[model samples]
Structures are given as C-alpha cells and as structure tokens.
Target: MSNNDIKFIHWFRSASPYIRVHKGKTFVIHMDDSVIGSDNFTGLVHDLALLNSLEIRLVLVFSTRHSIESRLNDHADVSHYHNGIRITDSETMEVIKDAAGKLRVEIEAALSVGLGNTPMLNAKVIISSGNYVRAKPMGVVDGVDYLYTGTVRSIETETINKQLDANEIVLIPPLGYSITGDVFNLQATALTRDVATKLGADKIIYLSSVDGISDQSGKLIKEMIVTEAEKYLLENKIPDAAEQQLLSHAVYACKKGIDRVHVINSSLDGGLIQELFSRDGVGTMISSTSFDELRQATVDDISGILELIVPLEKSGVLVERSREKLELEIENFTVMLRDDVIIGCGALYLYEKEMTAEVACLVIHGDYKNSGRGEQIYSVLEQRARENSIDSIFVLTTQAEHWFRELGFDEISVDELPVEKKELYNFKRNSKIFIKKLN
Candidate 1:
C-alpha cells in the first residue's frame, strides 16, 4: 500500500529464509551482567522470546560482573585480578553468588513477560536453569592460587539437550557448583565457550558492550575467519572488557568446532534479532567457512560463467555472446565464488585512449542476487579500473538500471561513450547507459 509497507514486506520475506535456517537449530547466546541492567533489557528479552516462538532451541549464558562488583564494593572488599581473571577468594564467592542468584531471577522474570499490543504479548516463553555445568577449582598457578575460582570440568549435554527439546530456554549462570558442595565463581566467557563447544551448538552469540568488534578507525568488521580473528586479536588493542571477552571467546569457540560466533552490542533495541535474522548482520561474525573467494576468471571458468548468465541471456536481459568471444575476453572478467561455485561475475573492458572502462556482463546467481555479490563484483572491477589509470567506468544495461543508479551511477547518453565503444553500440538492444566517475 505504501513504500514503507513494501520495504517491510521485502524485509520480512527475506528474513523467512534465515528463520527457516534457524528453526530447530540450537544456539547458545551469552550476555554480561550489564545487559540485564541496560535500558534495552526488556527489548532484548522480547527478542529472545521471539526466537523461542520461532522454534529455535536456545541456551542462554550470562555473567554477573557488574552486580558482583557492586556487592564487593558494598562489602568493603577491593577486587583483584590475576592475568585478567578475577581472584575469587571465598569472600568474593559470596558476592558472586548473591549477585548471580538475583540476576537469574530477574532474567527469568523478564523473559516471562506477557502483555497486550507488544512483541511479547501472547508470547509464552519457558525458561530453565540448572547445574548443567560441572567445574573444578582453578588450583595454584605460578604460586598464585585462584581459590574458589573454577574452570569448567564438563557440560551436561544430555540434560541440556532434553530441556531444549522440551522447548525450554536454558539460562546458565557463571557460577558453578562442585560435587564437593562448593559454589565457585567461573569466568563467564570461558564457560560460554566450553558449553558451546561441548554441546556442539549451531551458533554461539555474545551480546557485547561495544557495537561489535571495530578496527582502529572504529569501523565494525562484518565477518572474519578464525585465523583472521586470531590475527585481529593480536593486532587490535580493544578497550572494552566485554568486547575483549567476546572476541577472545569467539576465536576459541570457532576453533573448537563451533561453526559460527556472533558479537553484537546489547544496548541496541532488538539488536539480537538484527544480528541473527539479517544478512551482513549488525555484528561481527567469526565463522568457520570463508565468506567468499574472488579471483580472476580463467579459461577453466568459462563453463561456470556461461551457466551463470545463460538464463539472463535467454530472457533478453543480457546480450548473448559466442563462446569464442568470451574466450578472447576471459582475461577481462573477475568472478566471486563460494565453495567452488561461480556465484557472481563481471567483466572490465578498458579503452586506454579514452582512459575509461566498460563494466559489462554483470550477473549474480538468482539465489545470491540480493546478497551483495553484484556490488562486490563491481567494487573489484572499479578498483581494477583505478589501478589501470582509468578515469571513469560505464555500463550499458537493458535491466539493472535502478540497481546501478542506487550505487551512485548517473544516467548518460551513449554518445558520451568512448568512440570505439560508440562504434560498437547496438541500437537494437537500446540499452541504457550509466556512468560512474572514478576520480
């Protein structure tokens, strides 16, 4: 009915695929104590409830850092840390337990919300917590005993799985109890990574304090592989405690066989939903798989490239060219592939005399049309054109006019094209010309 409504419909339809992919998959999400106290806590709770309603099995892990600090402050004790870990003496363990117990109740209460005319309205979300984690004392190290500070010994996967199968969201706290009747303060990030690895979770997400992991310039990284994450952690001096913990544990989780680990800022309303449901999620994703592989197209890629564009050619949206012509121009093309499949491709034909390049034959597989592949291919060609001292880039298209226009291209008459290209222009095709200034 309206532009906004149409956009919403498109977004909703696009989200359905992700929803389907998430269905029945187990995800372990971790949040720090500050998340429970944030202004957007209620909204975060609603997102968790929505995920449950979507039939996604969830395991939520949380820490009581700020709350524990508050308790320690009130009890007249100064906190101590060894190698970035809190030295949890018996006295500190009391503050941890008190803070964690209160938080567990608050989290459960928040998730139990049921109201009218709201996202949580009519949403029935069941929460379950347990001693699902077994831990042992982090004994003396370097002559400094981490008394009452525990490391995860093992995770009760079967019990956690049973609760998840029963449609219950498992909320695990950072404190763990030993068989010897001792409650120990556990490092939340360590526990989250251990639990996710043990359960073989489909995904593990950390709701961070920062707006995901950012570079020195404060730009958030969209995705990275485990190796790249390791290098990043070594390179970036992240200032936020929560952000550092999320990154360190994300690298650990991905290396330990967890395929995906996401980090998003919990302060944003509905941030979790945006992180999970959207492509190029509103967070940094540390993944096991390489996101894409872009390289120059060779003769071997001819068949794959042809298959990629045959449909568009048949539909008269693309100008059909013979195999011999493609062979001659193969060196001008670049392809972005995933898992060895040529998902997208484009060609850059340079007119040296005019210092202009023609970008043509751009096509992304139907499934990947809206997945940013086309823009990626364009960027590659644009960069290549710049490297060759090209002054401008142009495209002639019977379709995708609006797509190019949206990316800062200006509609231009064909007469402005390079003289050589002008001579070859096909009036029968009547393709619209669009030009992008490179300088």
Candidate 2:
C-alpha cells in the first residue's frame, strides 16, 4: 500500500475509541454568520454530515451578527448597544429577523447538499428548527429601554431530545420567540450554552475565526479547566471579542455540568473531525474537570492497565502480571489517566521492615512515551514513598535501566536488594537493579 493509505488506516484505527465514546451523545455546535461565506464552509458542512453518519446527535445554534450588520449598513442604520450587547430596536429587530431567517435557510441548504464526488454524496441529513426556545426581553437596565434584545428563559429540552432521538440534526437560529407574540434577538454565545446545558449535551463546540484560546505568548492553549478559563476571561487575556465571549460562555456551560467545550477555527478543513476524533486535538478544550488525572488506581482501572502493560510483557521488557494479581495490588498502583484512559502506570510495593519500596511495572503507552508522562508518574511514586517514611526505592528492569538511572537511581547489585525481594527475584530474567535514595 502507498504511505498515504497506511496513514489513513492507522488514523482510522486510532479514532475508533473516540468513535465509540461519542456515539449517541449530544453535541451542540455554534457558528456565526461569518462562517457562512468562508471558503471552507462546505468542508465544515461535510464534517458535520460525517459526524451525523457516526450516530452523534447534533444541535446547531447559529448567529446572524455579520448578516445583521450588513443589513443595517444597507439601510443606513447604525447599531446601538449597552454593555457589549446589541440593543435591538424596532427597525433593528426587523433586520435581525430577516438576517436570522436568511441565514437559517442557508445553513439548512448547506447541510442538505449531496453531489457526486463530494463528501456529502449519498449522505442524508434531516435538519429540524422550531420555537423550541422561549425568551424574555432584557427590559430596561440603568434607565435605558432595551426594546427587543432578550435572554433565554427556558428551552424545550424534552421536545428537542425527541427530535434527536429520531436522528435529526436540530438547527437553532439566534432568535427566540416570546409568549406575547414577539420575536427577540438573542446573544448566540449564551444561547449555545443554555441549549447545551438544558439538553445535557456531552459537548459544546464553538466554530470561530480563531484557531482556539491562546496564552499571553500567543501560544495556543490546548486545554483548560473551567477555573482556568474563567481566570483567562477575568484577566482579559483573550484579545478577540468573539473568542472572549465564547470562553465566558464556555465556563458557564462547564459550571452547568457540561463536560467539555471546544473552540476551533471554522475555516480549517475537517477541523470538527480533527478536534473530536484525534487524541491531541487541534483546538482549545475547556473542560469541567482536569482532563488528565494522576491518582491511585482502583479495581475499576484493571482493564485499562492491562491494555497498557500486556504488550510490554510479551516483549520481555516488563514482567507479566495476572488480572487477579493487579486487582490485589490495585491500591499500590498509580496511573496517569487522560480522558479516563490510562496512558501511564507504576506500582509501589512497600517493604516496611526494609524502610524501602520497590517501584515496579513502570510502563507508559507507546504513543505517549516521549512526552515526559513517565517521569511524572515516577515522581508521584517517589513522593508516595517519602510520604510512607521510606528512605529509598528500587526498580528492576531488563530494558529501562538507563531510564531509572536518569531519575537519580544508581546501579545496584541484586544482593543489595531487600532479603524478601532478592528471594523472589527471577534468575531467568536477570534484570538490572537500580536504587534511588530519597533525602
């Protein structure tokens, strides 16, 4: 096979886990009017259709900001605002309604496209839109009458879920209806958050012009917890107004129990698929909790641990461990979990009488072996040893002796090992011993 074909097969296999994880889960995607005219908009639509084919329920909340601005400019009207929110007067509300309606139809058409040799060829997608969201006017604030600008009051979550249950992609425009027969302009960022929260969606994705959130150095921040997202917003670190608003709402969504919120550049081809399927996504991910957790392993983590170590055991790099043995020593194991997948693990077998512990089964998934994660796990085990009043730790390795030495362990003879460990050592393996003395 050609190199490209091999790469495709590898990527497809790698993405299988994510595919299984996302199936049947709800995701709310937000797109502004700006994306409609972008060169890669069709590519974005293709990715959406692909996701739909993967059995992921999708909800699209789209805004009309650019369209509204164009309409107002055409009519020689200027927009008014209060606290960064558009003040939708009678005329402005008319423009908003027209823009929102036009954009909704455009988006629906884009999603429905199917042609020969196109990604959406033979792809059938049903788009649903309605008065599933209710709103109330923002009313007067600081003695300024905000006529039609509004906030989401409630969402028809049950009805929306019913449509999703039927395998339809629910399309929501950035306009809400009121009880008094009124159409109100809504802020799309807050609207997306509210929709995801109400639906209990698994993810909220913002397709923006920016690639993702960045730090002061202009480096793209791959991930952040909710608190970190809030801090970035509070510090006014995000220079783009659109990104700032998305981050603010992302924090709100996380606080409301949504697990993950992604912000990716809409112009990038296949960006949605790349962000959702890849292990290291190409965009920013703000999560409710730490995405990578280092902690003591429980019995529940046995299967993941086995998936990591079983290959190494076959290669003779590490000793083989039985399921029952791991379960009995589960408390002694510390694992590095990324999105709940164990990527690295190590075990500390304590010997109280010897005032030392044996660090064993040090293994890292091959994909992440060079990322310094192994060192982090080893450090945690060393700290664990210190906490238990152990003066030193030892590791026996047939292949990783140099790695242990770099961590400050010195080469040691097997006779230097504790009596019990020496007695249990496998003569056939003949692994080198290394010990680190904790200060």
Best by TM-score: 2
Q: How much does candidate 1 score in TM-score? A: 0.70
* Native-to-model Cα distance after best TM-score fit, residue 302 in candidate 2, in Å: 6.2
The TM-score values for the models, in the order shown, are: 0.70, 0.83
How far off is model 2, as Cα RMSD? 3.8
- Identify the runs in model 1 with alpha carbons over 4 angstroms from their true place: 235-242, 293-439
Error of 1 at 286 (Å): 1.1
**CA lDDT scores, all candidates in order:** 0.86, 0.89
Question: Over the stretch 105-219, how does candidate 2's per-residue lDDT look in tens digits?
Answer: 8989998898979878888889999999899998999998788999999999999999999889999998889999899899987899999999999999998778998877889
